[model samples]
Target: MRLLHLSDIHGRVDLERILRAFNELKADIIVISGDSESSSLLRDLAGRTRVFYVSGNMDSISVVETARELGMLLDGEVLDVEGILLAGIGRREEHDLNRIRKEVKGDWILVSHYPPLDTKADIASSGRHVGSRIIRNAINELKPKACLCGHIHESPAIFRLNDTVVVNPGPAFMGRAAIIDTENWEADFTRI
Candidate 1:
């Protein structure tokens, strides 16, 4: 499956950019990690294709409300989409992590706001690793197919964590996004 990955959409990305990428890439799914508070953009995206989203530290409760209203929220839940299992954790909560561990049966993709600790995807502009330790442990043990995350605005690259591919499209507020072909696990990081 082809997946369009985006994160940290805090008013920099317009609907035109997202639609253009969706059409040009022929994406089958859209995975939004977090920090999007634009309900109109979310609604427009929902009208175009399937969207799964989480809330970030910068997001408001309205973000979750909008996702719930659209029935596309991915926080603290897992869903099987076209034979692919996707587990999401919006916050660094023990219950959410444990629930995924107890219920997830097979290979899945992890979508979160924070990246695995000390990984390439979670470095701050100051050079310190600000990722989630819990997420790091999960990646080491559960080993999801990919981890789509973005909290660090400058860290927008694709890398490997053992067997899983990790992609942080950086901040969409700065025109960053990605297209992933899950069939081959290749990513094309681009600007929106």
Candidate 2:
């Protein structure tokens, strides 16, 4: 499966640009990490292809409701897609290690708004690690196949924790994204 990861699009970008990227990249699934609140864009993308997303801190209730209506909300739930277990743990505010561990089981794919603590993807502009310790602890416990996340707009990177791949697709409002192929769990970033 080709997973196109996007994040931090706080409704500034256009749909045409993102669609063009998705089409050109030949993405099979679109994983949006957080801060995307444009309702039109969400509907358009969900209508076009498979989308699994978690609500970000900036996302409004309407956005979450829209995702739920479209059945594209991945927060606090697991969905089996082509035999791959896809799960989510939304924003950083609700980071519960026990709840996350209990709800999201197995070596599945995790969609979070914050990158795991201390990884290359978690560094802030201030140089201090503002990542979620709960997320870090959960990753150590769950060992997901890949953790797709965002929110630290300055840190866009792909790294690994043991066998688990961690990816932050930059910020979508900046016209950046990452295409991760599940066959190899490798990524190719595209910046428009």
Candidate 3:
């Protein structure tokens, strides 16, 4: 299955361009990690395409409420799409780390707002690992097929931890995204 991954919308992204890319990419589903302020836009997008999302640290409570109203919030939930188990966690806490490890099953895809610590995807401009150690530990324990996240704006890259492929598609508000062909387990990171 082809999945379009995005994160850090934060009200600055051009929704029109994102729609154009969605159409051109012919994606089966659109996954947004978080940090968006516009829940109306997210709800509208979900009406048009299959969208799964989580609230970020920067997201307001209203945004989460709107997503919950639309039944699009994936936080602490597991969704089955085309035989793939997809799980997501929004809050950045150690408790969530334990929950995520227990939530994952089989070859699943994990979505989070924080990148795992010490990975290439979490390096900051200051050359520090500014990611979640809890997330990293959970990843090491769960070993999901892929982990999609974005929190540190400057750190946008892919990393591998054993059998898992971790990716931060940069900040979508900056016109960056990723296309993942899950069947072949390949990801193409791009900027528009």
Candidate 4:
């Protein structure tokens, strides 16, 4: 299966280019990590693909409401897509690692706004590398197949931990995206 992973739109709703790319690529699933400031963009995207999204720090309640209205599942929801369990967590430092541990099963994909711990990616402002402790705990415990995240826009790195692949797609509005081929277990970063 081909999956398109994008994150950190930050209110830039230029769907025409994204749609063209999607159509050309013919991706089976689309995962939007977070920081999408526009509800309308989410609504528009929801209709185009099997979309799974999480709420970022910048996302408002109204944006989530619009997502729910458009039949999109918000944060802390699990979607079983063709034998793969796709789960999402919102932007919260108080993450329930135990719950994630219990809920995830068999070739799961985890989505969050922050990167996992010890990731060697560069930070934006301070130039320090920092990853989320909550996500680190989840990775250590749950051991999902892959984790996709995007909060630190400058830290765009793909790391391998144990059997899992952790990736931060950077800022999607800035033309950064990742295409994952589940069949081959490969992810390719693309710049549009």
Tens-digit lDDT track of model 1 for 84-186:
8888888644667877786676668988889888988888889998889988898898888888998888888799999889999988888789988878778
lDDT of 3 by residue, 47-121 (tens): 788888888998999998888888778787788889998888787456555566665688789888889988888
Worst 10 residues of 2 by lDDT: 91-100
- Which tens-of-lDDT digit does each residue in 1-192 have in candidate 4? 777888889897487777776767778877888888889888777777777787787989898778767766546667788888888777654653444556788888888887876675436667676778788788787888888889888888787877888778789989998887777567878764
User: How far does residue 190 in candidate 1 sit from its true spot (Å)?
Assistant: 1.9
Collision pairs in model 4: none
Ranking by TM-score: 1, 3, 2, 4
What's the lDDT for residue 190 in model 3? 73
Q: Candidate 1: list runs displaced more than 4 Å.
A: none
Model 1 TM-score (2 dp): 0.95
Q: What lDDT does candidate 3 reach at residue 147?
A: 89
At residue 131, give the lDDT of candidate 1.
Answer: 88
Per-residue lDDT tens digits of candidate 2, residues 1-192?
A: 888899999998787888788888888888899889887789998888888889888999999889989999887778888778888888633543434566565547888898889989989999989887777877787888898999999999988888888999899999888988888888777864
Kindly report which residue pairs in candidate 2 clash with one another: none
lDDT of each: 0.85, 0.84, 0.83, 0.78
* Candidate 3 displacement at residue 184 in angstroms: 1.3
lDDT of 2: 0.84
Could you tell me how far off, in angstroms, the CA of residue 85 lies in candidate 1 after the best superposition?
Answer: 0.8
